[model samples]
Target: MNNHIPILVEMQKLDDVIAEKLVLTESLPKRLSGLKKDVEDADNQVSETKTRLEENRKDQKLKELEIKSNNDQITKYKNQLLAAQSNKEYKALNSEVAHLESQNSLIDDVILQLMEDESSIKAQLEEELKIQANAKAELKANEDSLNLEIKEVEKEIKKFRDQRNNLAKDLPRALVKRYAALIKNRNRKAVVFNNGNKCGGCGYVLRPQVMIELQKGDEIINCENCGRMLVFHE
Candidate 1:
């Protein structure tokens, strides 16, 4: 009802938009971090798969070297069997050869299994690489746009805040101070519309006399419960 109410209402509108933009400013970086974390997670998956593949390859190499060494020892044993002078010596050499051949067979099976594991690891590596690529692309796609939106939101909030501050200059200092305190402490709602006989901000019951005074628009009337400046609404 006070003359300053209209100006205060206008300032509230600006402040509402500033508040909205400010929220966007806060959320944008969090969203960017989330997006970046996706890329990091995918990259880690790829790296882990590659490390497994590398380990598989190294194990295969070491196993192959073991087989080669066993084969060399078998050849030496065969030559010794040819030169053996006694029956016992020849039989011992023959036994050694057979044992070595059996060992080679087991080693071959191990090598085959290693090869199979290598194949599986390589396949997994390829899939992980693809996932990593897709995650990076997705981050690149969204990052720039989100950053731009964040900047734009910041600029808009600053602009709206400037307008609201300028408007405040035209109002009485004591009233502006009161409104600012309410806005800071009451979820940015220094002024609220009436919902029937209740305060819109806190649902506090408003008496008939207060409602009548609000309708009369003679002066500012704060809600008894919430202390917010009330605007009469249908």
Candidate 2:
């Protein structure tokens, strides 16, 4: 029974490694998801900026057409002023030309403002596009690295599992069954060291007789309260 303690300790070491590997496996996908989201957000910013620039260009075109139409109206009004038969008609034609010129002046100011805004927006869009490209490249590299790491971790877990199985084969069948049952019912810790006179698994105080048996290491001694295999390491 005392000889079996070393095998159980070895099994516990393998179980600890398996548990850590499992946690790492679960975290890899979450890391990949986070990187994907970063790239998506950068792409969205670039798309929205391009849409705004296109709309601004359309508005500038419309303003230029309006200015051209106003100029044509002014030319026609000047021709009517020359053919006027009365002073009143002449004044009316001149006023119409003035009104059209005034409207065109305002339109010109608006066009200039639109041009400035377009220039600024174009620069911003170029910068955003560059950032988006970099983000995509970074995501791809990280994804490849993470995939490789996941494979390595899986291989290590397999190795540890094989080692534990081989060790279990050396122990008696009944003892293995008992150890398995304890692991299932006791938080995966089938064997524990005594902490002074207390059970290390459940912190239960051992009776004087149980403590004496554990110290001798002659037979398997379970904690009376928690039923976990107790080992006394000198």
Candidate 3:
């Protein structure tokens, strides 16, 4: 049995585990950021709704003031009519009062429409506020758990790397260096199995002589195409 082959196999296994943990560690931060974004989007929706509601309410107040001002003008015109010195002046005062009344009627219709809009907006705002509150609570509840999970994954990755280093110490220094370089350059695959005369790493067809050498497993055999160590698994 080739000692380096078995050690390389073990190292490959450790690398596989490290690869999985690295992917998870990388994704955890993105997941946490997604959650944060959800919360932020919900908050923005609530804020926008509140702003619209405030503007609508302010418009409603302005409309009400305008109606009050119209009524005051109508009242002043009626008092002037009572002291009118000519028929023309009296008729003019009456026309002015009628116009003010018609204007007030139009403003009243607008106010009614605004009130309906306000009601709908208030309902929508209430719903958005609830959504925002729930999103905040969910983010707060999961934040610590997500951080802890990422830390645990980091620890596992560190442990696997340390184990790999320890395993490398038992192999020849040159062999370990070759393995490390292959793993770095070959997508983290230093040793690959020969699959039916095919190079498992690069899927290149293997020569009969190369397959024979891999089957003996007496020494490290490199795949001709990928330069990865080829091991025959009985």
lDDT per residue as tens, model 3, 1-234: 687888899999999898888889989999899889989999899889889889988998999999999999999999999899999999999999999999999999999999999999999988998888888888899899999999999999999999999999999899989999998899988889988889999999999898888898889899889999988965
Q: lDDT per model, in order?
A: 0.89, 0.89, 0.91
Worst 10 residues of 1 by lDDT: 14-23
Tens-place lDDT per residue, model 1, 16-81, is: 887787788889999999989988998888888888888888888988888899899999999998
Task: Please list the residue runs of candidate 1 whose C-alpha ends up more than 4 Å from where it truly belongs after superposition.
Answer: none
Error of model 1, residue 178, in angstroms: 2.2
lDDT of 2 at 55: 93
The alpha-carbon deviation from the true structure for residue 34 of candidate 2, after best TM-score superposition, in angstroms, is 2.5
What is the C-alpha local distance difference test score of candidate 1?
0.89
- lDDT for model 3, on a 0 to 1 scale? 0.91
lDDT of 2 at 79: 89
Question: How many residue pairs in model 3 have overlapping backbones?
Answer: 0
Lowest summed-lDDT stretch of 10 residues in model 3? 1-10
